[model samples]
Target: MSSPLAFDPARMFAVFGMRAVDSAGFDREVVQAPGDDLRCVFLWGKDCYNCNVFKQTAMLHKDALLDLGLTWFECNVYDDVALGQRFSLHGVPAFMMFRHGKRLGRISGWPGLPQFTEAVRRLRSGPAAPPAPASTQ
Candidate 1:
């Protein structure tokens, strides 16, 4: 068992694999308008019933995904409203997939690992280009 406060990036990659993006550093504004090629994980705080379940599942999957170098962002809904609406989230534990700043797909509720894995694979297989680097040339 891991400490509650401990954040293990490697664990996340193992579960989500290469189809996830770690958005832990993302600001509220950035998530609202994420650039191309970024997939976000919206983490609703413990206030919501669904959020609590999602967090637990996420914790278990985090270690697996982390080991595989997968990417994922954890966004606390309490911290951002604009982002929530941008994804049109009507409930907690929502997983929104985006590409080139456009929504590609989403799955809401406490989906089991198999379902979650499939959703991620489908999104990863979608046609989404990487964001262009800022011009410093």
Candidate 2:
């Protein structure tokens, strides 16, 4: 894959109307440490077929995001290497949820709309952090 920094945010926003960020933008303000709105970051690869499909799916459901007062963005892992590294991206077409600058949840690959919405609902309702690791007795 190409360097993640290579993706053009201008072009991304122009084409998708969804905020697309490079490493610089990613670090600047795309995520809020103590943010008020729920942020959904979609990580994709330019050459990934699944990413293309997910893009369409996301667009179709964008109103749902807006109604939920969610902020959605797309990042090309190929162009934003640092962001991908930060998220430890395992594959393309992954969706991650964030709020208050904290990651709430992530669901990899498209699991269909019903399942996807359920995941989003869970993310919106769940605590910012997962429960602490259990102690081994």
Candidate 3:
């Protein structure tokens, strides 16, 4: 088994086997670059409890997620303050979806594995984003 995370961003990326990107990468690769695959950018922060939970739970199933055909990248909002601001992110463990260098949608927290994956699936295949839960409306 892999070592447990120590709340360090680099360790977290290595542990989760996720590609870590900075604001420059986000702007260049995500905002400007074109791609056929749908993209999901995971936004996380240091020492975030929910982030750890999602990393251990939802992110652990990323191989299955990849099979569903969306590309994934992660960013540490704690280090990339500009990235957080650019997305208007209010919390850690969020998801920012994109398609062909355009914004698609965002999910603000770990909303359980099934729901989150469903959202990702819908975003990748359909034109509409998953509707906000009634509680948020």
Candidate 4:
């Protein structure tokens, strides 16, 4: 019989192929635009209950990640304090999506699956361009 699992963030993520990244790794891979494509970093903490739940919920739909076509990374912000500071993150269980070395958007907290999915959709679409100024004519 299989034994119960302990909350090892790295091991948990490894099961689904999310490479654990440190702040330097994040900057080199995600922030540097490894391929000028969307890169997503799942920021989490070691002792945060919500982070654990969020990770579980995300594990349910691993394909949702593949469908998004972005590189996936998991970071233990509780351990990598510099990462949290780089993004001005004040909390855990956040998803930061970046492209071309710029942040597209972020979904902070684990409200629920529906809200999270919708937020991902918006972030995937990326920031909207500003409207052109109207002429007086």
Candidate 5:
């Protein structure tokens, strides 16, 4: 495997492996799923124990995610701090969802694959409800 800092989208499938691509590649596969596909970006950092654990969980639940027709990508935050910052990611081992170049939702932290799947399901279900309207003068 290449250095953790390198972005390689192809290696994202391997255990704890994520594409160490540059910002452009990150835009292509991650920011934009390209052809309207539901995509999931696994945001992690080096030396992050929780990030490692989350990856293991993703490896185990790969099938489940596939069943949901979700495309996966691995993004090392340290490799692209800008991207992480843009997504408002303040922690490692975060999951960001996107479709047709638009962000759907995100779930941060290691809440287990089941919970992650559930959250993704929610994201897939439909748009989140808007806040109640404020009273008019």
Candidate 6:
């Protein structure tokens, strides 16, 4: 059988990884936007099976989203402790979708590719009117 695809955290991090968001910026960008067409953030703590699954799913969707003019941000739990605490991320492989800085949706654990795609679609479509205010508010 063909060898399993290698898991290169460095490469993945480079491609999908997020930059350091200072406390103020993280609060404004991730915790304070207020619309449907917001940004997408993926938080990963460890290189576990679930995180791997999500990574693959993201890879599949990355190109499509790029074509659609969508934005995605990746946060390494080890690197972003302050952001992690802000989100109360006690688990790895967590997915959070935001619009205008407000959290539109969140999915944790390994839901596989299908579920991940669905979550993205839903978030992209925006919350069903009357969305909650930004996190900072």
In model 4, the runs with Cα more than 4 Å from the true position are: 1-12, 127-137
lDDT of 6 by residue, 19-97 (tens): 4354457666665655545566667766566677666665666565445443556667767688778778888777676
**How far is 125's C-alpha from truth in model 4 (Å)?**
2.9
Q: Note the Cα lDDT for every prediction shown.
A: 0.58, 0.71, 0.75, 0.74, 0.70, 0.63
Single out the weakest 10-residue window by summed lDDT for candidate 3. 6-15
Candidate 4 C-alpha lDDT tens digits along 24-82? 76777777745656667889988798898877766666677457666778888888899
Q: How many clashing pairs in candidate 3?
A: 0
32-94 per-residue lDDT for model 2 (tens digits) = 445567777778888788886765665666566456666768888987788888888888888
Root-mean-square deviation of candidate 5? 7.2
Residue 105, model 5: Cα distance from true site in angstroms: 1.3
Model 1 global lDDT (CA atoms, 0 to 1): 0.58
- Stretches of candidate 5 above 4 Å error? 1-12, 15-21, 127-137
- Error in Å for residue 116 of model 6: 1.6
Which lDDT tens digits does candidate 1 get at residues 32-134? 5555544556546446767766656667666654442323555556567665666677777776655565656677877877787777777777765756789
* Model 5 per-residue lDDT tens digits across residues 57-76: 65566677567776667767
Better of 1 and 3 by TM-score: 3
TM-scores, all models, native as reference: 0.58, 0.70, 0.75, 0.74, 0.70, 0.64
Ranking by lDDT: 3, 4, 2, 5, 6, 1
In candidate 6, residue 32 scores what lDDT?
A: 67
List where candidate 3 sits over 4 angstroms from the true fold.
1-17, 59-63, 127-137
- Greater TM-score among 3 and 5 belongs to 3
Measured with C-alpha atoms, the lDDT of residue 91 in candidate 6 is: 85
